[model samples]
Target: MLNFKQPQLRDVIEAPADIAQVRTNLARLYQQKRQLLTDKAHWAHNDAALFEAGASYTRLFMDKMWEAFNEDKLIGDSALIEHLWLQVVQQEHGTAVNVNYADEAGENHVLFAIDQALHVQAHLTAHELPVLADITDEAPDYLINEKMFPALLQIIKLLYAADLRFRSPKETILQPVNDLHFGVKFPDAKTFTATLKVSNNVAVPVKINVEIGHYDVRSFQVVDETGNDVTTIGKPHVSASGTFSWEAQHLPELTNQTLTLTVEAVAIDTLPCLDNLFVIASGNNILMRTGEQVGSFQLELPNKQELGITVNSQDETLTLHYPDADTQIYELAKTYSFFGEWLEATLKTAIIV
Candidate 1:
């Protein structure tokens, strides 16, 4: 394992290391990000970086979202807009409605503008405690009603009165969440008491694992609240022993608040690099002998015994192999299309060396 105390990085800008090579990986990413950001005016703002991987938005809207989240920047500016309707709506209602509303565009095509607005609002509230604060950031009465609240309420009232008055959120095509199941669930609680229920359709008992998305509750003491874990709450224990369930309880000792729970499942399901990853092990990096041009490659580790390679991990040329083998990065045709940003050149099972 690579172990070192944090060193103060001053003049040394770029360097490479083998495992956990922080500088190398970040430098490469910086280069790639710079290349993408320089040409497009869309990703001018910080928040638009999320879209560069694969997003479809004009440069103006991306800038708007970033402004809302910046610490020094408060909720102002009307330049950012994804949909024309939102621009019109804000223009009409902004001043009258106490809308200091900085707008944002999010992940959807239509009503998602509302979602983006709400998301930005939620983010703003959570970060600044805007509700309790004075009228410095937003207008006082704007909090009286939201952009969609009045409309949704009107629709609800119409539905209750048996009147087909207002359209209900534009009919949406939803994916059926039937066959796919969250086989196991972990309950976040203090004292870490009770067993959580596991849901699955399989007749035979399959080893299921528990997940609390995006929170590390390892530091929480016994019988303490798992507040930071934004997942399902205290649940009944599963019948099977060794199965885990969690709960929230008061712990007066600890200062930094978090949750802790035990999860029981087979270790086989613990393969971290399975999805979108094929291998993780040591290997002698290789080179391809293609007729057209040469590229670098690595014999990436699948495990202790086997090694396979792709372009994602390391994208340098194999200078050691030289004339003997011209390296080319290859991938599966059915799964991947290209390496890095080359749009047309699809991946193949074997490198055409």
Candidate 2:
């Protein structure tokens, strides 16, 4: 019951012309196979030609093993047989079943493709004799089993490791090629609104893969006037737009306290310059400072690390010094002067570019 339209076995034939030298080889193969079938003691099936002299060299194996499928046959289709065959010889994966025949120790009747390949390969290697007679076979996974498989695997692993390539366990599946840009509009004191701009350069769906909180700065330090250090004050929350936030209330005594922030960014073999960051606040008086010196600070748009912030003082302008940098004072001219007499700043922000 096979469909010719869908692909069915019209022929099964494989033979090696050189193997014709052994008169008993093919004859014995057939003779023993027939006797085994007749014996029925170990016979798996009747009328199945385990050794077919008339079939082609490789087809002889299929002729014996084909068509006895239980529900859900492991073999995809008869079409797969093409991989096992050339004009006269079968290829690597489809050459033979790996099952070991009873002639060997701990062997079974099931002729798995790999087992058969190994058997044939070993037989050919040991003696100056050819079982198939017509073809020579040697390649990867040809016959991997008990005896030589471990050694073969060891050799392959050594070669693979030597290739100088590393496989990461935690990295995302694929890198995001599309640009990740966002715009932020702080509408009120309690909320921050942002817009995510993404592109469809990748075929797969895009999700936020890079999160700033996951990256840790080993040397991050925050010291309050009470001498309390809270470096791990909740990593800055990251949105699709790359905006990050650090909750000061979560840092124990950091809310109404004076503090200094120092940070360093390090990669495997390289280190970035350690930049000291500080934030001093009392009541409503806020003083934010950064860098080694003030004057050296460049007014680079979009690249400004410490943007303008609100602070108390008649000057209205927040003074941020770069202590680690050359002596420099960056006067943020756009100071939001408050109406109250004493210094008072509720929420501070930079001018939207």
**Over 4 Å off in model 2, which ranges?**
1-154, 157-219, 236-244, 248-255, 266-353
Model 1 regions lying over 4 Å from their true place: 1-263, 268-272, 275-353
Reference-based lDDT, residue 57, model 2? 31
Q: Write the per-residue lDDT of candidate 2 for residues 210-247, one digit (tens) a residue.
A: 22231222234455556576546545433434333333
Number of the predicted model whose TM-score against the real structure is largest: 2
By lDDT, the best candidate is 2
Error of 1 at 12 (Å): 42
| Each candidate's clash count | 18, 31
